[model samples]
Each structure stands twice: as structure tokens, then as C-alpha cells.
Target: MNVTLFSKPDCKQCDFTKRGFDKHGIDYVTVDVTADDSGRQKCIDLGYSSMPVVLVESGQEIVHWSGFRMDEIKALAYLEGAPQ
Candidate 1:
């Protein structure tokens, strides 16, 4: 499983979300919208017009959402065998 966080530097929710992942020891790659044009377009293409977008991939399935979804992250961390 792979988790990617799409965020800009000024987004507090994005920082909070990343902190949550760190707290649970969940590994993820962050894509900065203000810098990465292609990555930013992808985030926009995923039906998210906001920062703090998260894309989750498990096997051939990919899912995405925006905001600080703690409950969802917890489940994803477990699915990825992250230390709880």
C-alpha cells in the first residue's frame, strides 16, 4: 500500500494530517501543489479543489480524499501494517 499527501506549505490542515501520519509511524510521500505542476494537476483531477488531499493506493485500487481524516488514516495505517 502507498499513501501520498498533496499539500501546500501554508495549509495547516495538511500539516495536521502529516503529523497524524507521523504520530502513527505511517509512511507517505508529500507532493507540494505550489511547486509540482503535474502533481498539482493530478490532485485537481482527483476531484479535489482544496489542499490536504490524500491519495491511497492498495494493490490495483486507488482512493483519494481531502481534509484531515484521522479515522481513515488509522484504518489505512493498519492496512499497511504500520506500527500502531
Candidate 2:
């Protein structure tokens, strides 16, 4: 499974998302939308119009969402074989 977090600077929701992932021991890659135009465009292309966008890929399944979602983060922990 692979996780990608698209976020911008000075975003509280993004910070909360990251903290949630950290607390759950979930490893992920971060795409800075503010610093990376292509990343931002990718988020827009994915139909996300928000600051923090999370993309999760596992085998043939792909999941994505926007905003600070601790529930999603916890779900990821379970999916990734981490303690909830």
C-alpha cells in the first residue's frame, strides 16, 4: 500500500492529518501543492478543491479524500497492519 498526502503550507487541517498519520505510524509521501504546481494541478484533476488531499493506493484499489480525516487515517493504520 502507498499513501500520498497533498498539502499546502500553513494549513491546519493538513497539520492535523499529518499528526494523525504520525500517531498511527503510517508512512506516506507529501506533495506540497503550494510549492509544486504540477501537484496542485494533479489534485484539481482528481476533483479535489481543497488544501489537504489524501490519496491511498493498494494493489488495484485507489482511495482519495480531502480535509482532515482522522477516521480515514485510523483506517489506513488498520489497512497498513499498524495498531489502531
Candidate 3:
């Protein structure tokens, strides 16, 4: 399953989310909304004004947390059939 993470720089939650993904050995593509206008527009299109929006492979939103929630993410990953 593919994971798409929409994040912004200097976001502590974003960093923590990355750590969680690393711990799970999950491969994901991160799009920095602050650095890229297109990425920012994507976030807007998704109706998210905050950073660290996580998109799962099934077109479901696993997380839209302003802060990192490792356990929640882990559960969502498992439900999505992603590797732990």
C-alpha cells in the first residue's frame, strides 16, 4: 500500500509522524506543502488547513492530526494492510 504524507517544514508533529513511519519501516512519499504551491493546493483541496495529513492507499484518510499519534497511526496502518 502506498502512503502519502502531506506536511510542512518545522512542524514538530510532522517530525514525530516521520519517526513513527520509520519505526514501522513504512515507505511513504512526503509532500512539503510550504515548499510547493501545488502541494499546498492539494492540502486545500483535501480541506485540511493543518500539516501532517496522512493519506492511505484505499483513498481513506488515516490521520489528520495536528500532533503525532503513533498508536493510532499503527492501528490505521494495520487496518490498511500496511507493513509494520
In terms of lDDT, model 2 sits at 0.93
Q: Residues 1-84, candidate 1, lDDT per residue (tens digit)?
A: 788999999899999999999988888999999999998999879888888999988789998889999988888878877877
Candidate RMSDs in order: 1.0, 0.7, 2.8
Task: Provide TM-scores for the models.
Answer: 0.92, 0.95, 0.76
CA lDDT, candidate 1, residue 53: 94
> Which candidate comes out best when scored by lDDT?
2
Residue-level lDDT tens digits of model 2 in 1-84: 989999988999999999999989999999999899999998999999997999999999999999999889988899888977
* CA displacement after TM-score superposition, residue 34 of candidate 3 (Å): 1.2
Q: Is 1 or 3 the stronger prediction by TM-score? A: 1
Query: Which parts of model 3 are misplaced by more than 4 Å?
Result: 59-67, 79-84
Judging by TM-score against the true structure, name the best candidate: 2
Worst 10 residues of 3 by lDDT: 58-67
What is the lDDT ranking, best to worst? 2, 1, 3
lDDT of model 3 at residue 11?
92
lDDT of each: 0.90, 0.93, 0.77
- Of candidates 2 and 1, the better by TM-score: 2
TM-score of 1: 0.92
